[model samples]
Target: MEDRLLDKIAEPFNLQLPEYETLEAMIDGILPAVARFSEPNLLPEDSPLYVNSWVRMTDRPGATEVVMYRFQGYQQGEIRVVTDGEIGSKAYEVEESGDRIIVGESIMRDSFLYELSFIDDDFLILRRHGNLANIPHPYLFFCREAIGTRLTWNEALERLVDKYRNSQFPLLAVGLFVAAMIALLIYFR
Candidate 1:
């Protein structure tokens, strides 16, 4: 009976029952629910688009993992970490500071902080520290954006630049424009 039920569910996707079982197992055992729950609404509507830094420590020595963090309120705001050629479960933290901004204890010592920059109907941006300027590729830590919101990429970038003036990368604006062009090319091509 269970096999029959599984086959019925798998048929629409052209997957065998065993394949479905494997997928179900992977989703249930390995994937974190928070990450899964946060996946669907990554970007919000009319949100600004920005490029933020994402960092993760590597088992290797002296190499910090760097990834592009896209601020899209129309999509979803979940930040995912990928390391060692494997994508891990999303990071979640309980609020210790009674504020909307939250940081995990693991990174609190590094002065890591995440903020929800804007939550208006048409703009949202979550900014974080970027790669070290001097280092070619330093191990990045505590790079994340909160989930939930809708803002456009341009709007997100503007908000980030405005709020974190000190942390704004010098070439951020130019970089953003170029990146957008590249994305459009790839997307349309």
Candidate 2:
């Protein structure tokens, strides 16, 4: 069942998974490469599109191994992205199940197509197609230069909020801070 789904996702891109005796071997081979998609693509023309992704291997309970993955992209003019150059991200806890790399439980739907078109020490290419049949070529090609050395999830979230607050509504954020300070003074008095 999973194999069929993987085939279906790879069909549009005309790709085949590299021959590997075991899924573990495939996962281990690809995990080290940080896949990035930065070129402006034809798809999602309405928005500026870019994808930055990386996989982190963790030995966690419940599965053979867990992959902590981060996918951050920009939709041109997305408030924080434009002002701060900091785009929000989608984090996935992934695992290997059969011939598929399974994206585990999250707020997102469990089922999404992920296929490795190519992977090497410095470059990684992947194709992702979701149930949203409207968008085209979720495929991404990335270079190692795009990947960050150490960026935490909390830092990603905080950076996003900070960018939006300062860029989109600077006046409001400042006003609220001033009002809070004034209120504190009155309380103390």
Candidate 3:
């Protein structure tokens, strides 16, 4: 059942999970990774992009559906609700069958399926699994320190995401994805 899902998700990214013959293998490989984000408090104040909280770079609405995700322990809680005067006090776990990684409690457990399909120095793409996802997209794009909570990306982030969009929109629509680590270094630097 999930193998077909993997096929659909992996094709565009040009990925193959041939090594893991069954869902259990996928779970075993991903289990240790959960330990990394399981505890965020222990991490240093300055976490590099990959290890830091990844806000949704993909368009949906509001803030990054994922307030934060940690690599190397996972955090437990709800996705943040950052408003003008509010810095959401709590922020979000990982588990379950065929899911690459599942982390957090509350809305997270049932709402998202984060399978770590691709990661480079700056790009992190999660392939969604399960029909439980409330969101519409099959893939969620995120980058560290994305300016969220507002209705839209900040001007700088908007420009950054757009550049990648413009560059790859054509390919993406046709199912050929070209990952551009849009504004990865330029915006933060």
Return the top candidate by lDDT: 3
* Model 3 per-residue lDDT tens digits across residues 50-161: 2555555534344345454444333333445343335553332444332354533444334554665444334345566666355455555445554433323233233333
Give the TM-scores of the predictions, in the order they appear: 0.22, 0.27, 0.35
Model 3 lDDT, full chain set: 0.42
Rank candidates, TM-score, best first: 3, 2, 1
Q: Which candidate has the top score in TM-score?
A: 3
Q: List the RMSD of every prediction in angstroms.
A: 20.6, 21.6, 16.5
Clashing residue pairs for model 2: 36-142, 48-76
Two-way TM-score contest, 1 vs 2, winner: 2
* lDDT of each residue in 1-189, candidate 1, tens digit only: 547745664453352222222212322222232222121222423323324433321234444444333332222233444454465433233233312232332434433444342332222323233443643322122222331122322233333333343233456665676578668768988
lDDT of each prediction vs. the true structure?
A: 0.34, 0.36, 0.42
Which candidate do you rate higher for TM-score, 2 or 3? 3
Report model 2's TM-score to 2 decimal places: 0.27
From the highest lDDT down, the ranking of the candidates is: 3, 2, 1
